[model samples]
Target: MNDLEEVAGLLAKPEPSEEVVARSRSRLQHRALGHGARGHRTLGHRMRSPGRVRWFVPGVALVAAGAAAAVVIATGAVTNAGAPAPVSGKEVLLMAAVSAERTPQSSGTYWHVTATWLDSEIPPMESWTSRDGKRWTRNEPGDTSDTVVPASISLRLKGADVSFDDLEKLPTDPEALKAWIVQRKGNPDDMSTSEIQGDPTLTLLTLITELPTPADVRSAAFRALAATPGVENTGAVEGGQALRMPDPDGLGEEIKMVVDPETARVVRANLLLTADGSSGSSDGDIAVTTDWTDELPATPKDRP
Candidate 1:
């Protein structure tokens, strides 16, 4: 099982209070995901074995410092009052978020599509790999135990985890974002070769680091966002607008997350990472298409 599934296992323990179970059921109903804090691994994990060849898995990088710097620089060079540019930041961002490939599919009353959440700007993260790691199986569409994750570096996937680091604690604050920047200082440009589309709303925090046991970049989020301002009430950001929870990421990774805008709770989250390179190229030409709706039953077999 993967970290999320494992986490599910933890919460699934016989003690899940009626309220907790109800809450989990509620998320499936309304579909809310909160945004906030957001991660990496290292050498030994980097170099491949004597006979194993290294393959470049897509997505996964800590872009907080660089991304935050980009934000601060953009905000600093702009006007604080009066009518601003017609390309209002809000419009630019909203346009970025809602744009996607597949619209929600409807089968009578049920709509089925992937869900993703946005809070503010997101943080950076990396993946890891390890021998003892059992490919924490999140098993997304087209994914399998053999899925390439640059494992030689000991990197992890977004929903995967290790004993030392828990994926559920991803952080989301300026200080933690800043600290992440420091931690990933050496990788300022270790980014993998990939590009994102300009018009689509991409979830920018999906990352890959290390190369063994698998890790989810978002796993490091909660702790980072614990001290963040504004997001506490869900209405403090963007002049009364909630913006998306766990907003953008410091790294440039872009994957969408869907959460109940009001409650910051996750209903469903999409994990496909788009590439910036040529879309028509073989293997690179693929674009993720997802959809979700309520009427469907919540049985284990009916899930996407």
Candidate 2:
């Protein structure tokens, strides 16, 4: 099996510790009660709501699996011995950029993505966007609900409203892209000293995976992320070696991403907390699966 498939297999069979199970069960119960009383929002609403940041919470059955994946990664099981000696973060990103640049551009009436949010309280979220940027359809399988709306009401990346055209126009040069990202009102230049700083790398990573950006732009994003200071290669984790960066939100957290070396695509991401005298705790761990497809269902499945 391919490396990604192998990682997935390992992640699928977790042996959670008793403490982990207890924590997961408590979190699940808390979420159930909160959602039951407040009423859950539709996927469409959740997507557009700036305040709602969907976090992946492991379920009872998946607790061990997630822990296993993290442990294997922390222990370097994901690294391949046959691979060349480890390179600098910038070099690795440059390699990824080359791979992304060679990828074929996608064109279709709609951009469709099906993502399963493992360990999350919410169900899987599926979205379709019209090429002309006029229509959107979102489906939440857990609730058996679907919502159709204007593309103008779509999700934002790092609080920045962007469209397909904007993404296509992004600079491919790593330096240029870094300048562009830093100049954003939301991204502060003094990340090292500022009490608060936006994680531009997180924003770029989100766009690379969640948007139907052109291959060159995607590559540029990777290169830009590589050039970011404090970003480092954290050996193997899950689908591939992890590239880690400090959380820009100043929540005393760090962001770790598992990226496929062959394709330079992100396989998974984890938000781990940093606290003194505390074992590393994760605020959220997301496993994302994306597809840039040309076709989508003619109608929403659960349009009630």
The digit string of per-residue lDDT tens for model 1 on 1-304 reads 3212221332225344444444433332222123222222111122121211122224321111111100111111123462111212222122122211111212222212221122312221112222233221121212232232322222222212223233234333424433443333122122322211111112123321111101222222222332233222222222112223332333332222222222112222233331110011011211222222323233334446
User: Relative to the true structure, how large is the alpha-carbon lDDT of every model?
Assistant: 0.24, 0.47
Q: Show model 2 residue runs off by greater than 4 Å.
A: 1-85, 119-121, 135-152, 184-199, 271-284, 298-304
> Which ten residues in a row are the worst by lDDT in model 1?
66-75
Q: Which residue pairs show backbone clashes in model 2?
A: 14-64, 14-65, 16-64, 57-119, 58-119
What are the RMSD figures for all models against the true structure?
17.6, 15.1
- Candidate 2: lDDT of 245? 72
lDDT of 2 by residue, 89-142 (tens): 444454456567777885667776554445655444566766555445454322
Clashes of 1: 102
